[model samples]
Target: ELFYPKNKQHWREWLFNNHHRKDAVWLVFYKKQSDRKTISWSDAVDEALCFGWIDSKVESIDKESYKQYFCQRKPNSTWSKINKEKIEKLISTNQMTKAGFKAVERAKQNGSWTILDQVEALILPEDLKQALAGYKNALEYFDGLSKSNKKMLLYWIISAKRQETRQKRINELAELAGKGQKPKQFR
Candidate 1:
């Protein structure tokens, strides 16, 4: 269901009450068409993560507002550096719920908890970088892509669960980029 919280307190209350419910999906509204103030996305995310939820897809509802989808964090969901940092802060503040701690434990156990650095520090894996650099067409194409596109490509490679799979994906990505085509997942 969709939820519109005026501020962090309301969001916290909602998450505290609903975070344990597996069937719940929340679409949190932010911004407003009129003068009414609303909780900022950052604050909402803070509360959500404290309850072991993650923000997913977001959609615009009007000129002045949008809704962000939030769901329980799955066992293997990859963590973004930004979200990881926020979780750390929430932990230190003693805001993490039992469910939140369990999610962290699951991520740690599965080896995805610390896989990515902040976006600005993120680069394509060495093997992927070398492959691209060796192919002039791919190198040119990659250099021309927007920052988000480049990040998406690198992220896809990084998220691979095995070394062989990562290498295979890097090769495919290099070949696709060389041909001026987007990865199927990215496309």
Candidate 2:
């Protein structure tokens, strides 16, 4: 569904009504409209977070507006550091709903809440660094990667639940890097 909320209150009302029933909504935001004001993306996200929803998959609709997908937080979704901090503030301010608190508890129980810090530094692991050394092209390609891509690759490597899986990801990344290819999703 597509919704264009005039302001944060409108967005909050929509979430109040549909946070449980709807699987997702495409929230439309005005980019440069002079006569019509709309909720900014950051504001929209803050409201959504209060209701245990998350934003993803933004798409430009026209010069004046765009749509962002918002949906209920998945059971195993990894939380970002920024979002974690936002939730903390939300809790302190008494803005978080029962559903939102439940989602946070789930993340805490499953250990995804703390994993964001592991990826924040974006450092290459010793195993991957050594592997990349044997492939000069791969090392160069990794060096040339954008900071986000590098962080993502590092996260993929370090987030593995097992040492074997982590080693496997390191090998896969090195092999892909050697071929002058980025991970499929990044490309």
lDDT per model, in order? 0.81, 0.87
For residue 135, model 1's alpha carbon misses the true position, in angstroms, by: 2.6
TM-score of candidate 2 against the unseen true structure:
0.80
List residue ranges in candidate 2 displaced over 4 A.
125-146, 158-166, 175-187
In model 1, which regions exceed 4 Å deviation?
30-33, 118-120, 133-147, 160-168, 176-187
Give the alpha carbon lDDT tens digit for every residue of 1-187 in model 1.
Answer: 7887888998889888878765456555645456766888888888888888888888888777778888888888888878889988999999988888888899999876866663346466678779887766998888788888887777878878799998898889888888988789888
Clash totals in order: 0, 0
Residue 106 deviation, candidate 2, in Å? 0.5
Put down candidate 2 lDDT per residue, 1-187, tens digits, no spaces: 8998999999999999999999899999887655678998888988999988999998998888889999999977889988988998888999888878888999899887777675676667789999887775999999898888888888888678799999888888888899999768778
Residue 63's lDDT in candidate 2: 85
Model 2 has an lDDT value of 0.87
TM-score of 1: 0.78
Clashing pairs in 1: none
Q: Report the Cα lDDT for candidate 1.
A: 0.81
